[model samples]
Target: MRVLLVGAGGVGTAVTRIAARRSFLTHMVVADYDLARAEAAVAALGEQGTRFSARRLDASDQDAVRTALVDERCDVLLNATDPRFVMPLFEAALAAGTHYMDMAMSLSAPHATAPYEECGVKLGDEQFAQAAAWEASDRMALVGMGVEPGLSDVFARYAAEELFDEIEEIGVRDGANLTVEGYDFAPSFSIWTTIEECLNPPVVYEKDRGWFTTAPFSEPEVFEFPEGIGPVECVNVEHEEVLLIPRWVDARRVTFKYGLGDDFIAKLKTLHELGLDATAKVAVPGPDGPVQVSPRDVVAACLPDPATLGDRMTGKTCAGTWVKGTKDGSAREVYLYHVVDNEWSMREYGSQAVVWQTALNPVIALELMATGAWKGSGVLGPEALPPRPFLDLLGAYDSPWGLREER
Candidate 1:
């Protein structure tokens, strides 16, 4: 199948690497606003064939995105770009009459202020506002198919279906316990996204009561993962699964947490306290008097690009769903986790685990979709589909995944 791959950032780069190796994806067009990066991504594959090609695309531009899809005759449009451009690319997909998939859900525009700043709203639902229209057209948009929200959501369903009878709560914990050698500060994924998700107030969902808000990094709890990542502080964050899972399963409490260490936490708080997260541009007195810049953008520009961290990054990132409830009248708790080593992942896919794990899932989901194993219309999260086949297919990658009984 011909696939239209957009954006060539770290995640996008990893997606390209994995897609190049997939036999089902015979043709791929790697498009990005930064044309050089797109071409570099294609070159990195080292494949000498017309199966892979590069093109320049302004995914945010409606006409550009639609033209690329239509011209390429892509069977599916895979959005590996920033969440901010999700709607435009999705609209383009619908306009091009192709199925679509995105690794993560959308974010309020980077420079958003006040209301949307809270990040406590149902971001996923709001992002794909045209779900009904997609449904009407019989096209599919798989949302939040990344590592944390994607696999964690599917693990929850697997627990509900195969492990638990009376489910009480499902908590998704993501820990990035890695070291980037020489860099003092580097994000494994999108720096813009990392800032936005952590800088805003977090959200949680409860049975009957519905959704409610919490402070960013509130209610810090330490969880010890199975692969000996040890106990790491996991603080609440506004993740899409917390909003999506409750719609399909009955649970009293659902939450998402990130293991951002004290240093990162302190630094983020400082950025917020200094108002560096603001999207609005301001004039700074420079050599020529007034120069305009967004403090947030300035901060992001100063940090190391996450894509460059693969070789230098060392350690593991463990993310999964921890389910606690009753099974056949016996109280039980099971942790379904995926652990990825930065070094190995970098060697194999030329991507760090954080990028490798998230980027790979959506490609696999597309494999299922193209092969007719996964069929659905409109927008959907991981739990909306059957978990068995997806997880079974995911096993082909041979990353470490297993269930642990903490009874």
Candidate 2:
């Protein structure tokens, strides 16, 4: 299978390394808006003797994406790009008759200055609308396939099928307890995406009340993680898992939280208060005169490149789903979790735990698709398919999930 990956950032780099090692992939194309980043990613791959080619791609342009898919004869289009570029890439993949996979849902409008509200907007809702279209064409697209949305959703499904007679709640929690030595502030993932998810109004769902909104960082609680990670404070945040899981599981409650530290929350609040999260073009006086740029872009550019933080990062990422329900008429709960060590991941995969966990799982999903171990047609999230086939393959990648039944 030929794969065309459409981003060369940290996640893209991790995915490329995994894909290059996959025996099924005949050739891989690493495309990015910046040719240098693409070349850099491929160069690192070359050092590892992983065969890959690089290309300059304007991911925002639909025509360019379609052209690249056709020219490369790509069987799978892995979108490691930001959510802003997701829709066009998916559309292009559909046009070129290629399977599509991405880490998050597309922004409803790429030009929106603020995140969409919960009343009517949702992650992957736009793609879900095209489910019939994809099914008709015998194509498939997986959205929000990263660690939290992807793995957490798979955990929820596994619990529903294996552990619980009736699932009451699916709580997805992500805690990245890693420290990058040189920086007081650095996002483990994309700066733009972190800001969007953190600053936006949080959404949570209850079976009795339906979808509702909360202030960013509401409903704070401390939970103990397994195997020495200890207790970390988590808060309700807007994430795709809440939206996607509800489509498959009829849970009474669905929510997501991230263990973003208080200091980081304060910094994000400052950025929000200063209007630095907006995507609107603003003219600021530059050394050469007036320069037009987006504030969020400026903020992201001024930060250290996320791709270089792997070696300096140390700690573990313990993210999982906490499911509460009854099994065989008795109350039971289980924590389906996966933990990754930052230093170990960096040593093994040249990526931090956060990026390594998020980027590598999609390849497992791809393997299932390639081997026909899993079959589906249409736009689907992780829960829309069988969990064991994907979860069973995790141990091979040095990332295995655990299940802890709590008293």
Candidate 3:
């Protein structure tokens, strides 16, 4: 399978490393706005880089992306760019008649008046709205194929199909104990996305209440993560899983929470209070004169790029789904999770734990598409496909998942 990978950041670079070892990918074109970054990612592979090449392509240029897809004869376009570019990349793939996949979905907005109580343009709403067009073209646009929304959604489907007759709730709980060597505060993933998901009003799904919005960091709970990570305080965060899972899986409630401890939550709150999290352009003094810049971009620029922190990072990160339900007239509760140790991921793939974990699932999904093990059309989430094939493939990649019973 030939692929046009649209980012050269941490996750995109990790994807190259993982896909390099796999035999399914015949060729991959690593494209990014920065030519040097894209070249560096492919060049790092050495002999394994033979099947891969680098190109400079702006993700926001729809015509250019479409032309690249056709010029390279890529069967799929894997978007590793930030959420802001999802629409353009997605439309380009559709226009080029190629399959598309993204770790994060399109951007969202809060409801005008009832921002807390209601949801306006929820996550994946823009992508799903074009489902009919994709269906008509007989092509697929897989959104939210990253670790949490991707693997967690698959776990929910697995539980509903094999472990439970009726599910009460499916909550995605993400936690990490990883830290950098010197930085007092360092986000393990893209801070642009981190701010977008963390500070936005969280969404929750209930069978009766449907999907509604709540205050940011609402519904705090202490979730005890397995594999020595222990218990961490998790809180509601706007994530793709909450919006994607319910459309296919039956559940009374669905939610996504991150194990953001007090310091992290407090910092995010401060960024909100100071308007540092806003993405709108503001005139700021540049080297020459006044310049328009996004406050969030300035914040991201000041922090260390998460991709370069693999060598300094340590510990582990967990992404999983916790399900509560009934099976054969008996109550059941289980957490099916995938954990990646920073030491192991850094040693093996030269990628940090968080991005490496996020990078693998989409490649696995692509391999499935290549081998014809998983097939679908229109806009779909990870849950819409068969889960068993995906779960079995994880072991082949040397990253096995575990299940803990909490009953």
Candidate 4:
């Protein structure tokens, strides 16, 4: 099938590599705001005798995205853009009458800081309505199709479906040591998105009530993962799973934790206390006029590019979900997780684990939709899809989903 992939960033690059390797894509068109980056990715793909081209397009511009879709005549549109531009890309897909899949739910703005309640109102229902229309046309659209909200959500579904009669708590943990011996600072994914997550108050679900927690790296704990990855310190952080999973499954509590090194945590804590994580603008003197700059923007500028860390990056990232509750009148706990090696990922895809995992899921979801394995209407997360297909796909790539029974 012909597929059009937007955004040539780290995740997009990794996704392209995985898609190319699977031969799922007969013809591929990669687009990015930065033409050079898009061209670089296309050249890197080096699919011998395969149809591939790179284009420069601003995905935020509906007309531009529509034109590219129509020109390419793509059967599927894989959106790998920033979350802020997801809705518009979805609209473009609908206008182009193609199957749609994205890595995250549509966000109103990149730096929006309001609580979920307020943010939900602003997001409105247009996107869902569009998705329903696509479903009526027999075209499928899957939202929040990344590793955390994507696979972690699927893991939760697998447990609820087969492992437990009822699930009480779902804890999604993502831990990665992106730091090597030389690099001082590096984030796993997009620096801008990472900073936004770090600055915002973590929204979590407990007993069906939504609540907020402190900033990133605020609440710290040591979590012992399965064999190989070992014990790593994690902190309660905001993730799409914490926001979307509770709505799909009946659960007492749902939370997401991210593992960060001690030094990274200290830097975040210092920034939080100093109010440097704020999204609100502060006056700054300029040459000709007074400029308003948000702390998030400034900090994002100061951070190292996550894409560059793939080469120097060492260590593995352990990401998975934990479900604790009772089944058959007995207490039970199940952990489903994956461990990705950074160096290995670079050798394979020229990217890191975080990017590889995030990028791989959308392609899998698209294949399912194309093959009638996952076809549905309305807004849905990874948990809404059957986990077996996804689990099998992960296994094919050696990123198998593991299950452990705890008494």
Please give, for residues 180-219, the per-residue lDDT of candidate 1 as tens digits. 8888778777767877789766777888777777668899
- lDDT (tens digit, per residue) of candidate 2 on 1-407: 78899999888988887777777667789999999999888888765536589999999999999999999988989999888898899999999989999988966322144433344466677888898999998988988888877989899888888889998889998886678898999888889999888877777888888776677899899988886788899998878898888888879999999898799999999998999999999999999999999999999999987778887877888989999999889999889999998878888778877877888888888888888886788988899889999888898776789988876
Candidate 3 local lDDT, 1-407, one digit each (tens): 99999999999999999999999999999999999999999999999999999999999999999999999999999999999999999999999999999999988899999999999999989999999999999998988998988999999999989999999999999998888999999999999999999988899999998999999989899999988999999999999999999999999999999999999988988999999999999998889999999999999999999989999998999999999999999999999999999999999999999999999999999999999998889999999999999999999999999999999
Clashes of each: 1, 0, 0, 0
Output the number of the TM-score-best candidate: 3
* Each prediction's whole-model lDDT (CA): 0.83, 0.86, 0.95, 0.76
How high a TM-score does candidate 2 get?
A: 0.95
Global local distance difference test of model 1: 0.83
Model 3: pairs clashing at backbone N, Cα or C within 3 Å: none
In model 1, which regions exceed 4 Å deviation?
108-120, 284-291
Model 4 Cα lDDT, one tens digit per residue, 21-134: 775568879899999998898888775325678999998899889889999989878888877788789988888878777876654332255453333321213565565577
lDDT of 2: 0.86
Candidate topping lDDT: 3
